[model samples]
Target: MKINDYLSHEELKRLISALLVVLGFISIAAFFGFTVVPGLRYQAYTTGESQVQAVQGETGWLDPTEYPVMAKEVIPPIDPKTVMTPNPALMARGKALFAQNCATCHGPEGLGDGAAGKGLTPHPRNFTANAGWKNGTKLEDIYKTLDEGIKGSSMVSYNYLPKKDRMALAHVVQSLGAFDHGASDPKALANLEKLFASAGEVIPNRIPVSRAVTVLCREYAEAHPQPTATTLR
Candidate 1:
């Protein structure tokens, strides 16, 4: 009972053909599993990179800037009479200072239309108009406002500035309006003059935020040092 005895030649051929088909399918599967899939995997791991690299990669050093630290300085006493009215020299200095500091909130022409002032709650005071004077339009009043900032406003104390500079700024602020600025109160003017004549300002010391961070980090590292074998022993 050999296989040839039971099966015809045609049947043998069909059986051989079916085996060949099975073998062909196995060969194709092996090619993909062993060769093609591994090659594709190799290409992916070796050449391909994460898309996050494009966004997260830094081009240069990312050092943070040190915050400004004001130095302690003593300002000299100023004469109030000199700064009571806006002279050409005083106005020039005032204009320069305004451009440097106030222009961001107050417009170039003091229209309160400055870009920075737009987002302010009540908006910056419009110097061109005489309507809403927070401290009033008098020289002494404006001076007082500059020295002590408005309680509920974006205005901060300009007391950091010298009395002369603040007075000059007040004069410039007054000049912005075309309407008559009423006479300053006698008592207020007298008080301002006496203050200027008697007292001078002293700037306090300050430390930069970046420097402070560095100091804190150093202190922490010193306090909690990593243990080594020798230290453990």
Candidate 2:
């Protein structure tokens, strides 16, 4: 009121209008300073790259690569006696295979203390022990166990392994025991030799998981084509 008395009404109105203009400018400046400017500065400091496109194949999801077809072939006759002994090469291969496939249940040292066998009913076999093998500790017996697997146990058939590979594994299992693996029955040894000599093995055809997904997706798309604009109408 005193400021108004000092100035005329017209002058006071002009001052108030000028003050509002100053406040508006301050508000706009504050918004840019606190919000817009910081955002721009942060964007300038950013070092992130734009995402790359996903890989696409001929089937729109598969990578283009040649996958081998498993075909039928005659297995060359092998002497059982030759592979029954654990050679250095066979032991190395067996160790690798055991780690890959059997270690979850059989343990690294084949001591039957594997974590996966902790809850099983009849516990995994301890290869270090000379006794209590469901199948005898003979080379042939181990090979038979690998081929047929135990009926009421955690052991499953590894018959999918090649005959040579199974033989190598058998040798390695036998070697784990400190005691002597009793001699293989001569007739059983002869029979095992004959089985390899007489028969051929054929591995089933298979596809990679990625390739299978791609094929399934492609088939699904083909089977259920999308509705066109005209069709929707």
Candidate 3:
């Protein structure tokens, strides 16, 4: 039989008409998917979004009573005596902060031998020497040094660091000293106590450093719309 004999005229016409109907249906589907429907082709995106919202809502993140921020300590005035004790946990927390913020000047071993301190006038305090530290070797004294920094020297105030970090950093430095300068004299202790008392306790709800920096940078950009880099080539 001839290949043209496979379908009569009516059958051929019906087959071509069926194919046209299928193509038309596919075109309509493509048009609706690419241009008309919002998320019909995206796995019901709104439903998935609602699920995400449901999970976040169930986590108490939006609730006022969760108080997750309270877990972090800010520059809350701390007890000097407590900081004097060798707390492994506090020391651990301070290690990284010291390396990042202090080691450049103070040295990793607190030896006053850091590369940055090479030309500094007064020189960084050599923790192992145990001599002539402006603030002395006592806990409160060191905390004061960290908080207020020394004058007429390269040492600048680290008061911007949180109180907890300051205390922890104090301990990290103290741990480097050759000898614990046995407790401060009674008169000195009394003076330190009074000073700390004046500062009062500041209960911080939150003090996230990253967030603080981002906010500060945002403020800075707003203040200086056209900042110039004179030092950079």
Local distance difference test, each candidate: 0.64, 0.61, 0.56
The ten-residue window of minimal lDDT in model 1 covers 41-50
Better of 1 and 3 by TM-score: 1
What value does the lDDT take at residue 201 in candidate 1?
75
List TM-score per model, in order: 0.62, 0.58, 0.49
Clashing pairs in 1: none
What candidate 2 gets wrong by more than 4 Å, as runs, is 1-75, 208-214, 217-221, 224-233
Residue-wise C-alpha lDDT for candidate 1, range 84-162, written one tens digit per residue: 6667877876776676556666888999887767877778898988888988999988888987888776676676566
TM-score, cand. 3 vs. native: 0.49
Report how far residue 167 has shifted in candidate 1, in Å.
1.1
Q: How do the candidates rank by lDDT, highest first? A: 1, 2, 3
TM-score of 2: 0.58
Instruction: Give the better candidate number (1 or 2) by lDDT.
Output: 1
- In model 2, what lDDT does residue 71 have? 43
lDDT of 3 by residue, 1-233 (tens): 87459986656665665566556556654554444332111111111201211111111111111111234232445675654455766677667656655666678888988776777788878877778989888777888897787777767666644565667777788778778666867776576555544464443344223344346556644653432333222
